[model samples]
Target chain A: MIEVKNLVKTYGDKRAVAGISFKANDGEILGFLGPNGAGKSTTMNILTGYLSSTSGEAYINGHDILEDPIAAKREIGYLPEFPPLYLDMTVKEYLYFVYELRGCRLPRNTHLKEICELVKIDNVYNRRINNLSKGYKQRVGLAQALVGNPNVLILDEPTVGLDPKQIIEIRTLIKKLGKNHTVILSSHILSEVQAVCDRIVVINQGKIVADDTADNLSRELTADHKLIARIDGPKDEVIKLVQTIPGVVSIVADMQRERGVWEYNIEAVEGTDIRRELNRRLMSRNWYILGLRSSELSLEDIFLKLTMGESVNEFLADKADDLEERYKEEE
Target chain B: MNAILKREIRAYFDSLIGYIYITAFFAGSGILFSVSSLQYGSTDMSGMYSGLFYILLVLIPILTMRTLSEEKRQKTDQLLLTAPISLTSLVLGKFVAAMLIYSIGVCMTIVYATVVSFFGAVSWLTVFGNVVGLLLLGAAYIAVGMLISSLTENQVIAAIGGFAAMLVLYLISAIATIIPVDWIARIFTELSFAERYSPFTYGVFDFSNVLFFISATVIFLFLTIRVLERRRWS
Candidate 1:
C-alpha cells in the first residue's frame, strides 16, 4: 500500500505540486490522469524518494519516505518519464547493475532472466541500450524496475512513445503486474487510463479535481438530464420549437450532421426526462427527428469538465457561440 | 556502494576516456622521466616526479569530468538516487572509482623507477615517499574534480570547470606571492597545494603534509555529498 498526505513541492516561486493527497490499496492499479504540466511526475518523484516534498509525508508500506528513505525506497520501483538508462551498457549489463544497485536478495541470474522474459525484451537482451528502439528501451527500463520486485511500482507515462501494438502489449503487461503489485501509472491519454486502471485520479494544476473508479466518476459527473437530438428541419425553427417545450432548460444546435440536419444538445432541469417531450414538439412542427439519444458523459467529457473548470451548460454555451461566429463568417 | 564502484570502473573502460587517461599519464610521465633524468644520467627521480605534477593537473579533469555530470545529463541520476543507497555511499563510490583508475596510472611510475635503478643506485625510500605523496595528492585532485562534476550536467562544462579549479590550486602559491597583504598571502600560501606537495619530491616525509592531503580529500568529498543532498530540495 502507498499513501501520500498533503504533498507539496515548489520550485523557487512556482508551486509545481500543490497540496495533494491520495492512497493506493494493495493489488490496485491506480491511474493518474492529467494534462501535461500537471503534478503527476512530481508526485511520483517524491513518492520514489527522488525529490523531497516541501510540507507533507509519503509512506510506502507504512515507512515514511523522508524519515526512513532507504526502507521506503526499497519498497518502490520507479520508471520516470524518461527512462533512466546507461546508453553505453548492454541490456544484460544494465539490468545486472540495477539488480546490485537495489540490493536484490533473490537469485540474480534467474530473477533477471524472468524479468526480461516478462517484459519481452529477452530477444534484445545482449544489445546495447543505445542500439535498441524506443519501445525496447522503455521495456528495458521497466525490466530494471521489476528486478527487485518491490511491492509498489510507480510508472510515469510508460506508454508515451510506443506504437499502438506496443501500447496494447504494455497495457496488458501493466494489467498483469497489477494483479500482484500496487501500480501507480500516469498518463495524459484518457482512454488508455480508462481501459487499464482500476481507479482514476484526475489532477488539474497541481490539485486533485476528482478521484474514484472510472465508472463512478462518469456516473456522478454526468450532466443533469441531457439529450442529443438530430433534427431534420430549419435550424432557427428547430431551436424555437425546442425552447417552447416544458422542463427544457436550454437548447443549442451544436453541429451540422447531414447538410440541413443538425445535432441539437438539449439540457433539462434536474431529475427531468425531456427526451419524449422534445421528440413530440419537433415532430408536431414537421421537424423530422432523424436520431435521438440520452447524452451520458464519457470519461473524456468528465476529464475535460474537471480539468477545464467548465460546467456542461457553459461548455455547450461556448460551443453555441462559436457556431454562431462561424455562421456569421460564412454569410 | 560496491555496485556503483564496480559499474563506474567498468564504465571508464567501456568508453575511450579510460584508455585516453592512462595513455596520457604514461606518455607524459615517460617523456618527462626520459628528459629530466634519463637524458642527464641523474638518478635523482625527484625532478621527474615534480614535473609530472603539472601533467596531473590536465589529466585529473579528464578522468573525473563524467563521474557525476554524465549521470545527471543522461537522467540516470534518478536511478542512482532512487536506489536504496545513501548519498554518502553514492559520492564515495564515484570518488573511489576515479581514484582507483588514477592509482593505476600513478603505479606505473614504479616501472620507471625500476628502470632507473638498473643503471644507478636508487634510493628506494625517497621513491616510496614520492609514490605515497603522489597518490595522496591525486586523491585530493580527484575529489575536487568530482565535486565540480557534481555541480553541472554538461560534461564539457564539468571538464572545463575541473580544469579551471585545478589551475587555481596549481598556481595558488604564485598567486599568493603577488598579493601585497602579508596576512592574506600567508593564508593563501597555507592553502596552496603546491606548497605542501613540494616537500614530498625532496624526500621530506612530513606527517603534517600527509594530513593536509587526506583532510583535503575528505573535506571535498563531504562537500560533494552536501551538494547532492541539496539538489533534492532544489
Candidate 2:
C-alpha cells in the first residue's frame, strides 16, 4: 500500500510536481498515465525516497518516507526510468549485489534463482550486463527491483525502449507481479496502461486530471457520443435539419464519401440518442439516408482531451462546431 | 555496508585500477628503498618511510577518484541510495575499500625491509611504527579524495581536484614559512600533516600524532556523508 499527500516539488521558479496526491491499494496496479513533462517520473522518485519533495510526504505501508526512511524504503523496490545498472558487472553478480544491498535475510541461492526465473533472465545469468541486448537489460533491471520480494514496486516507464514482443513480455510479467505486490507503473503509452492497470490516474502538466478504473474512466469520458452519417441531400439542408432536431448539439459536414452524397458528423447531447428521429425526418424529406453509426470515444481520445486541458464535453462540443479550434487547442 | 564494501573492493581488482595502483606503489617505493637503505647502507627506515609520503601523494587520487564519482556518473547511486542502507554506511563502505587497497599496497613494501634486514640488523620497532604511520596517513588521504569524489560526478575532475588539494596539504609546512604573519604561519605549520607525520617516520610513536591523523580521516569521511545527505534535498 502507498499514500502520497499534497506532494509539491519545485525547481527554482518552476514546480515539477504541483501538490498532486494519489494512493494505490494493496495488490493493486495503479497506472500513472501522462505525456512528456507530466511529472510522472518526478512523483515516482519522491515516493521511493530517491528525491525529496519540496513540501509534502509519501508513505509506504504505514511508514513515512521522510520520518522513517529505512523502514519505508525497505518496503519498496524501485526501477527508475534508467535501469541504474553497473554495466561492468554480470547479471548474476548485479542481482546478488542488489540482494545484499536490500539486506535480504532469505537464502540467496533459492531466492535469487527464483527471481531470475520469474523475470526470465536465467539463460543470461552468467553474461555481463553491458553485453546484454536492450530487452535483456530491461529484464535484468526488473529482476533487480523484485529482489527481497518487497511489497511495493515502483517502476517508471518500464517498457519504454523495448521492441513490441519485449513490451508484451514485460507487461505480462508486471501483471503477474501485481498478483502479490502493489505496483505503481508510469507510462505515456495508453495501451500498456489499459492492458495491465486495474486503476488509471491521468496526470498532465504536474497535476492530476482524472483517476478511475479503466472501464469507468472510458464510460464517463465518452458519455456524449458522436454519430457519422452519410445522406444524399444538400449539405445546407442536412445541417439545418440536424440542428433543429431536439438533443442534436452540433453538426459538421464532412467530405462526401460517395459520389453526390454528403457525410456529416453529428454530436448528440449527453444521455441522448437522436438516431431514430433523424432517420424519420430524412425519410419524410425524401432524402436518402445511406448509413449511420455511432463512434464512441476511445482511451486515446480521452487522454488527448484531458491532457489538452479541455473537459470531455467541451472537447466534443468543439469537435462538432469547430474542427479548427480543436486542432489549435491540441497544439 | 558490507555488500557495498565487497563490491567496491571487487571492482578495484576487476578493473585495471588496483593492479596499476599497486604496481606504481611498488615501483616508486622500490626506488626510494634502494636510495635510502642500499645506497647508504643504513638500517634505519626513517628515510624510506619519508619517501612514502610522495608515493601516496601521487597515487591516493587515482585510488579514490572513482569511489563515488563513477557511481554518480553511471546513476548507480540510485540503487544504493534508495535501499534500506544509511548514507553513513555507503560513504564509509567506499572509504574503507580504498583504505584496504592502500593498506595492501603498503604491506607488500615490507619485503623491502626484509631485503634490508639480510644486509644489516634492521630495527623491527622502527618498521612497525612507520607502517602504522603510513596506514594512518593513507587513510587520511583516501578520506580527502573520497570527499572530492562525492562533490563531483566527473572522475577526471575528482582526480585533479584531489591531487591539487593533496599537493597543497603535502607542502603545507614549506608554504607556511613564506607567510609574513607569524601567528598565521604557526597555524599552517600545526595544520600540516607532514609535520605531524615526521615523528612516526623517526621511530617516535607519538600518540597525539596518531590521533591527529585518525581525527583528520574521521572528519573528512564525516564531511563526505554530510554532502551525500544534503544531496537528497538539493
Candidate 3:
C-alpha cells in the first residue's frame, strides 16, 4: 500500500501540488486523470524519488520515500514521460545495463529476456532505441522498467501514441500486471481509465479533485437518468401523455414525427426505471409503443461535472463555494 | 562506473570526434617528429618530447571536448544519473577514460626516445622523467577539458571553451615574459605548466612541480563533478 500525507510541491510562489492526502492500496490499478500541468507528473516524480517534494511525505509499502529512498525506489518501477534510454545501446544492452544498475544481483539478463518476450519486443531487442518506431520503443521502455519486477509500477501516459490495436494490447497487459502489482497510470483519456483502472483520481491544476471507483464517481455525479420513448399515436397526444407521467419530467419530439408515430426523450429520477410502467400503461391505452431507451451519465459527463475545469486553486475555490452554499442551505 | 566508462569510450569511437582527435594528435606529433628530429639531424629524444608538449594545447581539447556534452545532448545523462551508482564514481569513470586515452598518445612519444638511443647517448632517467611529466601534464589538460565540457550541452561550446582554457595555459610561459616577474607575476609564472615542465625536460625531477600538475588535475576534476551535480538541482 502507498500512503501520501499532505503531499505538497511548491515552485517559488506557486504550489504545483497542494496539501493533499490519499492512499493507493496494493494490487490496485489507480488512474490519475488531469489536464496538462496538473501536477500528475510532479506527484509521480516525487513518489519515484526523481524529484524531492517541497514538503510532506510519501510512504511506499512501509518505507518512507524520503528517509529510505533506495529501498522505496527498489520497490517501484517508473516510466517517465520521456523514455530514458541510451540511444546508442541496442534494446538488449540497455535492458541488461538497467538490470545491473538496479542491482538485481540475479541473472536479470534472463529476467529481461523474459520481459521482452512478455512485452512482445523480442524481435526488436537488437535494434537501437532511436531507430525503432514509437510503439516499439515504448515497449522497449516498458521492458526496461519491468526488468527488475518491482512491486509498484508507475506509468506516465503509457499509451498516448499507440494505435487502437496496440492500445488494446497494452491495456490488457496493464490489467494483467495489475493483478500482482500496484499500478498507477496517468492519462487524460477518461474512458481508458474507466476501462482498466479499478479506481480513479481526477486532478485539476495540482490538486486532486475527485477520487473514487469508476462506477461510484459516475453514479455520484448523475442528477437524473435520461431515456427516450416512442409511442404510436398522434404526435401531439403522445408528447402530452409522456408529460403527464408523474415520474417523467421533460420530452423532446425527435425524428419520425411526420407520421402518426412520435419519439421523445424522457427524464426520470435516477435509479427509477419507468420503462416497464410506461410500456404497461401504453398497452392498456391501446397505444402501440415503437422504441424506448434511457441514458445514464457517461464518464465524460461525470468528469466534466465533478471537475471544475480550471486550476487546482480555482477548483478548490469552487469547492469552497459548494461548501459555503451547503452551509447556507443548512442554516 | 565501468559500464558508463565503456559506453563513453564507445560513443567517442562511434563519432568523428574520437577519430579526428587520435588522428590529428598522433599525426601532428609524427609530422613534427619526422621534420624536426629526423630531417634536421637532431637526435635529442627530449627535443621531440618537448615538441609534443606544445602540440597538446590544440589536441587535448579535441580529445576531451565531447566527453560530457554529448551525454547531455542525446539525453543519455538521465540513464547515468538514475543508475544506482554515486555521482562521484560516474564522473570519475568518464574522466579516467579520457585520461587513459591521453596516456596512450604520451606513450607514443616513447618511440622518439627509442629512436634516439641508436644515434646519441640518451639518459634513461631524464627520458623517463620527461615521459612522467608529459603524462601528468596531459592529465591536467584533459581534466580542464572535462570541466569545461560539463558546463554546456552544446559540443561546439564545450570544445571552444576547452580550447580557450588550454590556450591560456599554453601561453602561460610567453605571458610570464610580457608581465613583471615581480612577486605577483613570479607567483603566476610559477603556476605556468610549461615553466614547471622545463625541469623535467632538463633531466631534473622536481617533485613539487609534479605535485602541482597532479593538484591541477584533481582540482579540475573536482570542479567537473560539482558542475554536473548542480545540473540535477537546476
Candidate 4:
C-alpha cells in the first residue's frame, strides 16, 4: 500500500505538482493518467524516494519516504522515465549488480534463474545492454526492478514507445505481477490503463480531479450523455430544423465531406438522447441515413474531460489524430 | 557493499581499465626505477622512494576518474542509490576498489626494491616505512578524487578536477620554501605533506608523521561520505 498526502513540488517559480493526495490499496494496479508534464513523473520520483517532497509526505507500506528511506526504498521497485542501464555490461552482469546492491540473500545461482524466467529475458542474458533493441532494454530495466522482489512497483510510462505487440506483452506481464504486488503505472494511453488497471486516478495540473474504478469514473463523468446525428439533407438545413426541436439547445455543422454530405454535433439542453426523434425527422424528409454513431465516454474521453478539454476538438468525434496532436501540444 | 566492490573490480578488468591503469603505473614507475636504482647504481633506496611520489599525481586520476562520474553519466547510480544499502557503503566500496588498483600496481613495483636490495646496501626498514607512507598518501588523495567525481556527472571534468586536486597536494610540500617560514606561515608549512614525510626518508620513525597521514586520509574520506549522503536528502 502507498499513501501520498498533500504533496506539492515546485520547480523554480512554477508549481509543477500542486498539493495532491491519493492512495493505492495493496495488490492493486492503480493507473495515473495525465498528459505530458502533468506531475506524473515527479510524483513517482518522490514516491520512489528519488526526490524530496517540498511540503508533503509519502508513505510506502507505512514507512515514511523521508524518515525511513532505506526501509521504504527496500519495499519499492522503480523504473524511471529513462531506463538506468550500464551499456558496457551485459544484461546478466547488470542484473547481478542490482541484485547484489539490493542485498538479496537468496542463493544467487537459483534466484537469478528464477527472475530471468519470470521476466522472460533469459535468451538475451549474455548480450550487452547497449546491443539490445529498445523493447528488450525496457524488459531488462523491469527485470532490474524485480531483483529484490520488492512489494510495491512504481513504473512511470512503462509502455511509452513499445510496439503494439510489445505493449500487450508488457501489459499482460504487469497484470500478472499485480496479483502478487501493489503496482502503480503512469501512462497517457487510456485503453492500456483501462484494460489492465484495477483502479484509476485522473490528475491534471498536479491535482487529482477524479479517483475511482475505471468503469465508475466513466459512467459518472458522462451521465445521461448521448450524441445525435442525422445523415442527409443540407447540414445547415438539418441544423436549422434541429433548433426547432424542443430539447435541442445547439446545432453545429462541423464537417463538409466531399460534395453535399455534411455532419454536425448537436447537443441537447439536458443530457437527453434525441437520436430516435432526429432520425425519424430526417427519414420523413426523404433523406437517407448514411450512418450515426454516439461517442461512448470511455476512459479516453474521461481522461480528456478531467484534464480540461481545452484543445480537444469536440467536432472530431474520437479522431485519434486530434488526440495525438493534443498530446504533443501538452508536451 | 561487497557486491558493488566486486562489480567495480570486475569492470576494471572487463573493460581493460584495470589493466591500463596498472600498466601505466608500473610502466611509469619502472622507467623511473631503472634510472635511479639500476643505471645510477645508487645505494640510496630512499631517493627512489621520493621519485615514486610523483606517480601518485598522474596515476591516481586514471584509477579514480570513472569511479562516480561514469556511474552518473550512465545513470547506473539510479540502481545503487535506490538499493537498500547506505551511502557510506557505496562510497567505501569505491574507495576500496581504487585502493586495490593502487595496491596491485605498488606490489608489482616490489620486484624493483628486491632487485635493488640484492645489488646494493639499502635500509630495508626505511624502505618498508616509505611503502606504508606511500599507501597512506595514495589513499588520502583517492578520497579527494572520489569526492570530486561524485560532484560532477561529466567524466572529463572529474578526471581534470582529480588531477588538479592531486597537483595542489603535491604543491603543499614545497609551498613553505616559496612563502616565508614565519610564525603564522610556519604552522601551515608544518602541516604540509613533504615536511611530514621527510622524517621517514631519513630512516627515522616519527609517530607524528604517521598520525598526520592517517588523519588526512580519514578526514577526506569523511568529507566524501558527507557529500554523497547530502545528495540523497535535499
Predicted structure with the largest DockQ when compared to the true one: 1
Model 1 residue A89 distance off true place after TM-score fit, in angstroms: 0.9
Chain A TM-score (model 2): 0.76
Q: List the candidate 3 regions with Cα displacement exceeding 4 Å.
A: A1-3, A12-14, A59-69, A221-304, A307-331, B169-187, B197-199
In model 1, what lDDT does residue A87 have? 97
lDDT (C-alpha) at residue A324 in model 1? 61
**Residue A325's C-alpha lDDT in candidate 4?**
52
Off by over 4 Å in 2: A222-304, A307-331
Which numbered prediction scores highest in lDDT against the true structure? 1
Cα lDDT of candidate 4 equals 0.79
Cα lDDT tens digits for candidate 3, B9-98: 776777766777778778977887788778876765666677777788888888888888877786556555644466688788888788
The model with the greatest TM-score is: 1
DockQ of all candidate complexes: 0.83, 0.73, 0.32, 0.61
Candidate 2: which pairs clash?
A: none
Candidate 3: global Cα-lDDT?
0.78
Candidate 1 wrongly placed segments (more than 4 Å): A221-304, A307-312
Q: How many clashes (backbone N, Cα, C below 3 Å) per candidate?
A: 0, 0, 2, 0
lDDT of 4 by residue, B64-114 (tens): 888998887887777777777777898889989989888887776567777
Top-down lDDT ranking: 1, 2, 4, 3
